[model samples]
Target: MGSLLDNSLQIISNTTGKSLFVRLWPLSTAPKGIVYIVHELGGHCLLYDVIAARFLEAGYTVASHDQYGHGLSSGTRLHTSNYQTYVADTLQCLEEVKCQYQDTDNVLLFGHGVGGLLAALLAAQNPGFVKGLILHGPIFKFLEEHASTVNVCWYLSYVLPLAYSPVNGTDPALLITDKDQRMKYARDPFIWHEGPRLSTIHAVTTAMGDLEQVEEPLSCPTLIQCGQDDQLLNKTNLTAWSKRCSKTTKLLFYEGAKHYLHMDTPECTIKVLDEMVKFCDVVRSEAASDTDDAVGSEAASDTDDAVGSEAASDTDDAVGSEAGSDTADD
Candidate 1:
């Protein structure tokens, strides 16, 4: 148990003026590449440590940072006072990791729930930065439309800004089937059960709006996994969204699984990870081949130019040597 607990660590780091907490799990062997795992709304990085450990076991470095206004991150908990700031903060984290891991060219972005939404936006913004994407039950839009009454309440809270209101219509039991897991989640010191800020709801809505208009074709390979019984986004929308992607995208739906498919079906999740690793390997091989072809073309061009120059020089030398020999013989 002591050795098991030693594998995880809670790291507090500063990013964009906020104290952001992250969970880092390094593999025993050198990592193939770094994976940036993003958590759901109101969820901390530690919640996904088990998932990260699986990746670590597969010889990949896993890192997850709590989003602003959530977990150990220093900001308004449950409030979306500045949604764009959250996006920008995520971008900063990516840049920081990219700088830190200069040797590792393969970077995979994994996001679950709302984190999946942000991951998609980030990938859409910078196509070349992410090698592949793993979206687990992404919250593209709310299951039910916000009624006018809720909107009015949200507006009032926005005016008040600090006023707290209970988020309605969320089934706590749906998150996890295990009673111990539910109890642990509720009693966790870093977890926040309070309703999200009015500003956050507005920000999510706005982000959804932007996601709808994202016409830029993503170049990275993507895998989107959703539970068939997901109470969040239904299957129809998930199918539609998957079709919008231009790159190689595979969507898998597990029957009888809920929103938290990772916890529900760990074996399936691991299988998906293996598939991703294989896909990345193929991409790397193709990229290396392309580079080799370009180098070979340049080398052949250089060799042809050198042969022409050598031939011309040989002709001149032959003429000079023959003249000298003839004059000497005369």
Candidate 2:
């Protein structure tokens, strides 16, 4: 039972018969709000300890559950039936946390990588469930770079749904620009590196397609941040999301960071974290407003004009400097 100074770790089980190891960082008084942390492919709830502590120190209660197939949870390691499975698990964990904490309706969902995809789709699918959505290096284009390989994998899913196969090997360095961070990831005993199963590839493709098809404005305020030097995803994905999402979407490309911007050193990581905290503050104010529509409209316009403009004009510079600095080490 690992615990924080003001937190406790607990186990939660859902209907799927999976027991997720969930942790909490609680506030002494009523929390400002709740933030649910959803991690990426190789990540678990515990791996987000830093962010959870940071949010706790900032007056928000934080809770996170290890995905069914990952971390301390029981399942076929690093596998899931489809995207909905992950979403269901995440939603269940949130409810359990809320119940445990006696929290109110105000909620913020934070996701990274594939977890980002799950969070965005969940908020999109369930309107008003979350007041804020934060996606760091969201997976928009999953394995499209290897379309031929993915097609073969998708076809194989019909016969070998449970069989595991490898995606192209990813460099650990791509996750963070810091040498010590990369080394820590390499040594992390809990990391899952077997890559995606066929079903997951198929689910990823389908979910991304579904996200692209939704033309309606996002129901909740969203902030999407991707490192410009990210090796896991590209700027094309950024452009697609900027265009695909509502005016409420705030987008940013960190100048010299990599895919795991949250894990990057303070110079780069703090900037993105600061932006996220600011965006959440804006949404919390909106939630407190007497008129929802007016605030939403103004916020959407400001996001569109500010983020959309910066995304276009600054990405090139961010990309341009990638060659000279240690950024390319990712």
Candidate 3:
């Protein structure tokens, strides 16, 4: 993580005046595309730098940020009034990335766990916001051990919605098998360590209902990856959600991997990252195909000069900046 932070690290705030920490990587040359990533619950931008670096090597200018209360971003720590607030915050973050990249299309969304949930919701709610999406081990539900206590949480939420739940918390060993990685995860200062907040849990509960009723049938290219051995949530929910997508959708289940697919064993991580890069290639190919078809349509029309201007505009819209692309201030 430290190694990947070699360039363009920033602490920028959102519209709420809540300081938002973002890790952005602009390619050495003009990029073929751009990607916006959201982190898992309790995850910070630094933890995702490895994945961001992979995007850089793949020739896409990359950007990602910590959500309010989760990382260096300012706000309550891992607590919010409603889950929709997260969705809204993510939408704002996406807008900032688009403005910075001067991109309306050619942007893809990547999320892990809760980040995946928010990304999925954002894409479903707003069509054409992203060209594609890639989700890694998204949490569809809490662990079974945690499930038995939901009713109590739901009832208690009314009394003290912002209170933290008294649970022993997760065992890092369960998150990843490698001892060193487990130790690193345990010691990671940015990870939210203090047991769950009732407000946060309540928001998760409500998000379940919201996701169930979204009905948008995701319009973009989508990819969902889950671990067969994941103790947190089964693939059933993930499968059900994939069915709602209107366009291309692919789901893969890893045999021996755990919840943190990104930080799994070297072999697993290699496979996962390779597959993800390949997925991006498909998106790039599709975008290129669209541009070619647009140019061909214009050429076929009778008006030669008008067609040239239209083709040029289409090319610029897909690749170059329009006018005012925003960048972080100090």
Candidate 4:
């Protein structure tokens, strides 16, 4: 079993005119593919070390970058009023990984909560870059059935972009039924308690609107897994999102789980990872088969050319020998 430190690798993205924080966990055998993991809201990449390790163990090179204004990244903490900056930063990070790991057999994106929303947006925009998607508790609709509150926030953010307000009446403990996990998250220093900025909320709302209007079918394979008891999203929204997706989508609903399924029920999460890796393995095998066929065809053509040359030489020698024999006989 690899330790947490063993899987840690520093990554930086200079595409956005600034260096951003990223971490990678390379599989022991260098992995069959690469996966870009995006953390949930108010969480850092390091908090996902344990989860990343599961992917590493399953022979995947897992990498995650902290969004600007969060974690170890060099930016204004708790200051991103607009969430588009976060999405743009994530795109830069993905580009860096694609460049650095050019030989990766496959590329998959895994995201949670707001990160999942960003992942969906990226997948919607750049459909060809990612081979597949794994979304856990994606924020398709914010505040669940409480549309009134969401509308109020949306209006406020549009009018006052700089407004800040603490999310009221949310019990952190209710996020997960697992007491141990809840306590750990509560005490984790990387977990932020501050509410989102007005701009961030606006960005989220805008993203949701865009997501709702996504009518074009995605060609890539997708997996949408959510906890049955997640408070942030409802089953109706999840079902609607999955139905709108192309037929190449898989949905998993975990009973009695919470938003942070990876932390609350790791075994189930690992099972899902295994399924994703299996899908990637099949894709890689097909690609390898195609390459081998191309090489084989070229080799066969070369062999045929060589054989034809040898046959021509033999014919020439036979004709010369017959002529010489005829001359001798004459």
User: What are the lDDT figures for the candidates, one per model?
Assistant: 0.72, 0.78, 0.77, 0.73
* Candidates by lDDT, descending order: 2, 3, 4, 1
Model 2: weakest 10-residue lDDT segment is: 1-10
User: What CA root-mean-square deviation does each model show from the true structure?
Assistant: 4.8, 19.8, 12.9, 5.6
Best by lDDT: 2
Worst 10 residues of 3 by lDDT: 321-330
The top-ranked prediction according to TM-score is 3
User: Which segments of candidate 1 are over 4 A away from where they belong?
Assistant: 1-15, 145-154, 164-170, 177-180, 265-330
Error of 1 at 144 (Å): 4.0
Better of 2 and 4 by lDDT: 2
RMSD of 3: 12.9
lDDT of 1 by residue, 255-276 (tens): 7766766565556556655665
TM-score of each: 0.81, 0.82, 0.85, 0.79
| lDDT score for candidate 2 against the true structure | 0.78
**Which lDDT tens digits does candidate 2 get at residues 72-135?**
8878777665778888888877877777556467799998988888888888888878899998
Residue pairs in candidate 3 whose N, alpha carbon or C atoms collide under 3 angstroms: none
Cα lDDT of model 4 by residue, 1-330, tens digit: 123235355546555665567787765565677888888776788877766776677677878888876777776555565666777888777776666566774788888887888888888877777778888888877665567766777778767766664443225665665777778888877666666666677677788787778885355778888888888766677777787777478888888887887767666556655665666666566656778999999999999999999999999999999999999999
lDDT of 4: 0.73
TM-score rank order? 3, 2, 1, 4
